[model samples]
Target: MRKSIIAAAFASLAILPAAASGAEEPPHVDYSFAGVFGTFDPVQLQRGFQVYKEVCAACHSLKFVAFRNLGDAGGPHFTEAEVKALAAGYDVAAIDNETGEATTRKGLPSDHIPAPFPNEIAAKAANNGSAPPDLSLMAKAREGNASYIHAILTGYDHPVPEGVQVPEGGNYNPYFPGGVIAMPKPLSDGQVEYADASVPRTVDQYAKDVSAFLMWTAEPKMEVRKRVGFGAILFLGALSVLLYLSYRRVWRNVDH
Candidate 1:
């Protein structure tokens, strides 16, 4: 009996590697905002916001972001009026002062983005027992960040490989862990009309744009932080040069 149990354990351990092998590494993308000097593209960020509002918002939420962030420097840079107008369209939770009862009011630029569902339980109930993750920090939280998102979004194009069995309500995506994902293919060609006529209206573009936008949401102040770091580097470099000159001058007459 003990031998049989040990054999069963070994067999399970052997299966683990095979299961893990199903998920493929996401392809690298040369995003504009990739390196130390990276900067977010305002136009792309705007388009991504549109995609999020029209499609992803139905299932996922950007609960950490606010309407005012749309107008912040180094972001989408939507005008103040536009931000206010957009905020007014959404109803946010509030409490009535007179009645002391829970209610809702039009969203304000200051308010955090509201979730599609009131809570996790409702979100799960609406999405086949699997709650769609909040996309606010998804870019930062995931292993490959934006690239992983792009891969998962476009990975649905291929048919399931042989010997793979996708469970009910689960979709096969080699980019997704365990070779299955709860969410179906969300983006399709020409699904959302782009205001910019130059950009292609395709799934790949949509995925890329949204991925960049999510990255911005994850690190809204990334540009500012980068700028500060660069400035500090310059200051330190100047200080080092000055100190070296002073040391040479001070030790010139008393050389060791």
Candidate 2:
């Protein structure tokens, strides 16, 4: 009896890992800016911004990004004139410096993007008790970066495995945690038309575009960092060469 019990326990342990591994993993994607010298693609970022504005903004918040950042160096680089126009669309709260009164104003380059809901409670009530996490840090926060984001947004609309029950109002997505998520599948073909005829207007295309955009929001200074690093390497290389020549000159005509 003791040996039989031990064998059963060992079998259970072996099966657990296999069950866990059944969860689908995010697919790998070759992002344009992924290496030491990678830079964000401006057009992809812009299309991503459009996707966020039209769809994800209804639930997710980008509170860390500023209106001016849209035009900032090494980011979306939208012209200042364009940023000004974009800011005008969102109203933000302001305090009257002298009168000590609260007021509303058009968003500025400096202003943080406003939350769609007034507070967490409102957001939870709307989304079946799970307030969608803020997207400002999502790219850096997740394990797979843009690939994970793109996978999730495009993972829905497929059939689920047999006997896997999805709770009422909950969605079944193999890529999401526990194979379930509260938010419904948010993308569909032709959901948002792209202004650039060059880019495709499909669900997968939209997912990829927005994933790139979010990566920029999470790491706005990536381009500047790459540029500075490159310059430093050049300077160090020149210095090394000079030192080597100087050593040879100092040892002129001397036998080792």
**TM-score per model over all chains:** 0.88, 0.83
Residue 6 lDDT in model 1? 100
The segments of candidate 1 whose C-alpha lies over 4 angstroms from its true place after superposition are: 1-22, 96-101
Q: Tens digit of lDDT per residue, candidate 1, span 74-157?
A: 999999999999999999989999999999999999988788998999999998899999999999997899999999999997
lDDT value for model 2 = 0.89
Best-fitting candidate, scored by lDDT:
1
Model 2, 1-256: lDDT tens per residue?
9999999999989887547645566888778889998888887898899999999999999999988898876777899899999998889998988898998888887888888898999999999999999999899987788888998998997798898889998998888767888989999989998987877889899999999999999999888889999999999999999999999999988998
Model 2 bad stretches (over 4 Å): 1-23, 95-103, 249-256
Q: What is the lDDT of residue 161 in candidate 1?
A: 89
Residue 144's lDDT in candidate 1: 90
